[model samples]
Target: MTSPILRDPGNSGFVVELEKFSGPLDLLLHLIKEDEVDITDLPIAKIAVQFLSVINELGLNQAADYLEMAARLLRIKAQMLLPRRLGDDEWEDPRAELVRRLLEYQQIRELVEWLGHAADARAERFGRGYEAPPPDAPPAPLQIDLNDLLAAAERVIALMPDPNLHHRVVPRPLDVEGATARILALLAERETFGWRDAVGGGPQATLVDVLSTFIALLELAKRSVLTLSQPEPFGPMVITRGISREAA
Candidate 1:
C-alpha cells in the first residue's frame, strides 16, 4: 500500500513518505505479523536485516527513535549468534525484552481499537433532545412571603459590622493662614532659603502640614511675595524674596 507523504519540520522542502506504522515498534510488529512467526521465538537475524533495509529505504533523515530501534535489532541479532556454552541450559534469550514490548504494544493497540468501535456505537444511540421553554411563558411565583423576606433582610443587616466603628475624626494640624505666617517668619530670619526649611521637620512633617505649606507657597507665589525656582528638574524649590517682599 502507498504510504502518506509528511512534510519534514526541519526542512520545509523535504517530504517524508511514512508507512501505515505509527512508530518503530509498530513497524517491528507489522514485520513480525507478516512473517507469521511467534513473538516469543522471534527470528532475530531475518527481522534485523528487514528492519535495517526498511530504514535505509526510508532515507538517512529518519527520526532518531527509528535509528535507535535499528541499533537494538542489530545488537539482538549479534546476541543470538553467540554460541551456547556446553552444559549451560539456563541461557536467557536476548529477544525476550523485545518480545515483551511487542506483546504489550499489541494489547494496547487492540484495546484502543475496541474503544474506538465502542465510542462509535455509543454515538449511534440517542436521547430525548432538549426542548426550550416558550418565550411568552410566565415566570415562576415566589415561594416566600413578604414577612419571611423582611426577616431574612433583618438577619443579613445584623451580620454587617457597625459603620460607626470605622468612623474617625482627626483635628486639622495647621491651616493656610498658619502656613503663611510660618513662611513669613522664615523669610524675616533669612533673605532666601529652601521651601523644606520653611515647612520644617523634613520627613517627620505630617501630610496635613505639607499640604497646608504647599497651598501657602502657591498663594505667596501668586501675590509675588516670593519667587520659586529649581535650577534642575525635580530639584529642591529655591525661595527668593520677590519685589513685593523686598519693597516691604
Candidate 2:
C-alpha cells in the first residue's frame, strides 16, 4: 500500500520561512488553514479529499513530515466512516482527537505570537536612537540589601543537609525580570499567595522560573524597594513593596 503524503505545494501559504515543518501535525495545521477548514469541527471527508489531492500533485519525493500527518488523517477518516453497530458503547468520533490536537497547536501558536510581540517591543525600546542620559543625571541604580541576599542564600543552602553538599548545589543565575513582574502583579491583585502556589506545578523550566522569581523579590527587598515578612520566620513570606513602582 502507498504511504500517505501531502504533495501539492500550491498556495499552501505556510511557505513562510519557518526552520522546517516539524512533523505531520505541522503539515495538517498548514493544510487546514490553506483549505480554510474549521479546526473545531474538522470535515474529515473534505479534508481527506483535499489532502489526497495534494499528495497526488506532489507525486514521489514528498517530505516524510507531511506524509505522516496525511496517513493519520486518512486513518481518522476511515474510522469516522466505519458503520457503528447498535448499543455500541465504544463508538466515538475520530474527529475528536484531531480537534484536541488542533486546540493544543492553537495554544502554542498564540504563545509564539505573544513572544514575537514582546521581542518586537524590546527591539524598538533598545533601537539605534536610544541614548543614555548624562552620568551626572543618571537614574539611580536599584537598591540591593545585604540581609536579603543572606536570607535568599540561607533558603537555598537549607535545601542541602550536609555542608559538603553546598558544592553540589548549583548557584542559579539571578535574572528573572518577567517572573518577578508576574509575582508582583499577582501579589498586587491578591494580598497573599503561598510561595508554592505562585510557583505552580510543571516541568523543570517552570520550577526554575519560580525560584528565579523568589530570588528577584529578595533582590528588590535588599534595595529596600520591597519588603518581605514571615509571621513565622520559617513560614511563607508575605511580599509587599516599599517603592511605588507599578505592580509587576
| Candidate topping TM-score | 1
TM-score of each: 0.44, 0.39
CA lDDT of 186 in candidate 2?
A: 72
**Candidate 1 per-residue C-alpha lDDT over 1-248 given as tens digits, one digit per residue, 9 for 90 to 100:** 22212323344333244656678888889898999988889988788777776655565236677778888987888888899997888998889999999999999899989999999999999889868876896876656677767776885576455687684344875588988999998888887999678787775565677788899998998999888887643346888877775567
Q: RMSDs, each prediction? A: 21.0, 22.1
Residues 1-248, candidate 2, lDDT per residue (tens digit)?
Answer: 34334234444433222344445566567788887868988988778766666554544225555556677788998898789998999888788977898889878878988999999888776546767775786676645477766786886675545665444434565447866777667767765565654554432334456677788778767876667776644456677656555654
Residue 94 CA displacement from its true place in model 1, Å: 0.5
Judge candidate 2 at residue 127 and give its lDDT. Answer: 46
C-alpha lDDT (0 to 100) for residue 3 of candidate 2: 32
